[model samples]
Target: MPIANQNLFNQSRSFYLVSILELWQRFSYYGLQCILPLYFVWQLELTLADAFRLFSTYVALAFGFISVGRWLGEQILGIKRTLLLGSLLMMAGYVLLVLSTHKNGLIYFGLATISVGNGLFKTNPVALLSDIYNRTRFTLYHTLACLGSITAIILTPWVAHHYDWNIAFSLGVFGMFLVIIHLIFGKHYLNQYGTLTDQQPVSLKVGLLVSAIITAAIVFSSFLLHHQTAAPWILVVLFIANILFYWQKLINLKSAMRRKMMIVFILLLMVFVFFTLYLQIPTSLNFFAIHHVSHQVMGISFLPEQFQALNPIWIVITAPMLAALYNRLGNYLPIPHKLAIGMVLCSSSFLVLPWGATFSDSSGFISAHWLILSYALHSIGHPSISALGLIIVNRMVPAELKNFTTSMCFFTFAAAALTAGKVATQTIAPLYANSPYISLALYSEWFMKIGIVTAVIAVLMVISAPLIHRVMQSNQP
Candidate 1:
């Protein structure tokens, strides 16, 4: 092969490897996520409030550590080694979870391990990919991640139902084991990328730094797990710290890059909002489905957790089409415009739920179709904002800042997860306890309020599109 062709092949090959690793990683992560709420409620016998608090704290810490992971990948272990370390840790975490069946206290330790592992694993792949390919390819990668999520969502529930929770948790261990194996074998293909930090010898000082950070993360995460109320306040502190860090970075950038970074900051705030709403799927929405939505469809009864698969299933179907459409349109549809549309779609998804509730049968169970439709809308809205925001942030920043900015994006998600947890605790949990008979009605009312708020934000985004677009495009050749 010619040099150019060989390089192209290598790039595509490396991308495929990274995407597959992401698939398996998400498989473990989402599989665990789908079962966690139910596990908290049923097996652990926790109240809804406590469950949401724990769930949110686990999620928050998981994404929160991405910054530390990015630093590890960039300054200490380098990408490949860090990825391997993370996978191994995640596998161990799952093992602990499996053992939790015997001693329930193990679950907290297990969750903390997974949170740190996920922090280390999640951002590095996208950072590696940005080096190999342009933004256009990211949507396909997102689809792969969604594919993993849907697979886990469908399988975990069935496994837990028929077999045991330990076995289901073991599936995560299996998934991470695949990731570790794949990374070891696939390291050869990625030798040309993400290796800068690996070239340096690990001095004792640097080694100690890495150790200290990792130890701190695990300790702090455990603290948050035990003191769930502290999670939100800590999120506030982290949010402020993030803003300060970005503000410093913004002033240092060149004119065009500065404008782009500004846009990234704005869009990240939107990301927080979008994900805060999106995460309701696993938390509040899951509970709602369990309590009010009929599980039967066409004479088949589905697990509540299985319904979570619908979002990813819709993504699997829609992502390719949307990618093609975006390519066809080129610059005609700007990022802000797409984000606005996404917000609107997300709003509609929630708005429909209230209306759907009114159609419930005598048992107070709404049709499963309503949940399906809501997920469809939510899934369609996802790529427009979530995936696109990632692409934009990666593309806009300088190469040196790519991993940091990517980690920052995950930080927003971390904050949003905590916010979503708080929302569920405040909005959904209270209704369940205080108004048992009108719980569904109250849930619908909260959903309606969220929908209205999101719709307003979408309109504001639409109005701001021109300025954001101009700022983004200015000083470009």
Candidate 2:
């Protein structure tokens, strides 16, 4: 009984940490993504095309740096130093952003800080979570991270309303500071951070080359786009380097997956598709809330800016309940069923988005009460999906390759987040030019098309659910 209680206590502690840290991280990250476009367009008077490009670039950079951080941390730097360095960079970024008066230079400093800081924080957090939990408890613990993400969404609007965006961002810095406390005290729990003794670390020169390549690509891309100062074959070189990195990995692939490795590869690929869909909450839903919804209320409205908060809020509320349901049904249903449910819930939210769009063009600066209702539902759908994803990734992976494995999963998420913004940037531009906002009609058609496709995918997943279940059971040692 005491052993069970200790297990429960550790689980509880781990969950609380994951939820809270992610809550802070997302609160900062999403808030900027939510606010930056309007800030540029409204405050700086930049054109939508310019603002959208800058925002997409920044988001993509964040994703790119995450891969950098994960690779460096796992290879050369220990997770401890990597996390601490990340926090310092993030805090520095936020500080510069808050003080940034000029429109041009301010964004640069902020990006520099955020891009690096996130590389540090985002890569290690999941690895840390995996270190804390066993196979069965994986779902509940990861649900905490998902819940943290959800909670960030729920409170962002409220915080943005009550305080300036700068003030709200400082809260994230505070969260980073809070992580130092745990890092100091809970160092023992971070067993999953180091590389396995049997495996050799990648060479440092190759690592530096990879870093230099990423940095140069980002620089050339930004300069060429922003300044229209194209240098010769910059992208060609970067592309070749990236291709080479992967080609090298391909050569090493035979040795990479000596253990239960196919699951990581498969899950990474599958999740890239899955997250590409879910990560749209920040990008596509932005226009959906601003234009399609019917009403607005309080400081919170169903504006595109406000919609990002919903997924986070709903996750906080629903995660515990969903975790409970999964635990109860664990005996009866397999993990794949839970994943199927999550997929259905995600696609269903899009179906509902179109319905809400039909009621009003909240795009024309009308109220957002009805739109918020739609957002509330969207938020609720995410936790189950996220929790189950944790179960799938963590359970299928062996302990020795935790960070490397989790890095692949992180790449999926990073790729998805970047893709969401990129797709939104491209798709929303034409709509904005034609309609001035995401018109109710346009919004409806968009969601309907997406919903139909997602629904079909969900159906296929449902059919395959049993196969995954059998796989999990068969693989269980």
Candidate 3:
């Protein structure tokens, strides 16, 4: 009984410590992201297309490499050293970004460093957290991290708009160092956890060779795409590779696990589509808000970047209401059907954007009300797709493949980030570039096309929901 109590105390202590570190880390990351597109266009003097591609690549790479980082943490550096290295690398990246205000090469190098660092920092800490706490306590970590991201999005633009870019990047540097300080003091608690004995530690020679190859690859890719549009193609190739890999995995698994995995994959693809539309908040929609939406609400001036907060803000507000609503509905509304309903809601939000676009004035500045409604709809619709997707994936994935499946789930976000970037550049950016403010007709037309596609996807999801429910029911132990 005493031993169990000690274990619980250890877990509670480490979870709080880890949560703080994770929160600040996300704050640093999202702070950079909230203003990254604007920085590229306004400061770096890049075209909208170039800016979108670069931002997409950065976000995609940052997320996509998390699986690799997890493997490295477990196999090469172990949990403790990997976390330390990742924090230092992140700090270095921010320093380089701060320097990029004076020079361009620093920008890419800094981004690459941050990409690798974030990939490492993001996953390894979760592993450590899991070591201390059971699945039920996991939500606390995610919820806190979400709050950090939300806070960053809200505050970063305010800082950057009021101050300067260097100060903004410096905020990230400060946050990264805080993570280091917290870990340094708290390592004793975490050190007793998350050891993998089967995997051999990476040797110095192998590490050097791998580092050289990665550095060379980064340099080559940067040089190759320095003056071109390769981001979309890269994402497409990755999606295809993922599809093939999953297909092979499906063939190898037992029938019950295989069916469940296949359903999860389908659901993930739908999520990819949903985010391709949803994540535009940070890229295309952000630019749209800045250029075309009115800055004043009831005669009060506001920064354009502040609108990005609507997503997370609304999520926090509406998620409980949604959970309550779903609970009231009970088992009558199965998970798959609820997911389908969410997809439909998401599609409706896109459609709402185009409808609101028609109300823009001659100045092409739409009322803040329209953007507000669109965001509100998105807030409601997003949980249906994203939050539900996470829940369903958790329930569906077999125990043995949980980690790998979860890693694949992260990959979906990476793919969505890349897809969102492509959609923003190819579909949305062109309409806004030629005019001082994008016209109401242009806005309507642009979103109308996207709305139609998502609507079709939603309808398909509705059709399949029952079958998915049946499969899940049959497959359960």
Q: Global lDDT of each model?
A: 0.85, 0.58, 0.77
Q: Is candidate 2 or candidate 3 better by TM-score?
A: 3
Clashes of each: 0, 14, 0
> Candidate 1: which pairs clash?
none
Write the number of the candidate with greater lDDT, choosing between 1 and 3: 1
lDDT of 3 by residue, 1-477 (tens): 011223343546667878888988988998898899899889889888878888887877787768767776777667767777788878888999888874667788788788878877887877777677665565456667768878888788888888998888898998898999998997766655765722356788977965774466446444423533665567568667877877887788878878888899898888888877876888878888887889888898889888887777777677777777888898899988988887777777768877766777777778887787788877788867876888788888878777777778778888788778778875453443666444445556767888788889889889999998888888544
Ranking by lDDT: 1, 3, 2
TM-score, one value per model: 0.91, 0.73, 0.87
Whichever of 1 and 2 has more TM-score, that candidate is 1
lDDT of 2: 0.58
Scored by lDDT, the top model is: 1
lDDT for each residue of candidate 2 in 1-477, tens digit (9 for 90 to 100): 011113355655544555456555665676566667666666678765566556655654566567667765666565555666676667767777777764566657566667767876675766655555554655455555555455554555556667676665666566566666666575554433444521344467865874575466445444643542122233235434644553454454444332235544544555655666665655566655555444346654343565566655566567667777867887687776766676676677778766654454334443465455555555555655555676676776556555555555554565565455455554454534566344555556766777787678778778977766666655334
Candidate 1 worst ten-residue window by lDDT: 1-10
Model 2 Cα displacement at 269 (Å)?
Answer: 4.0
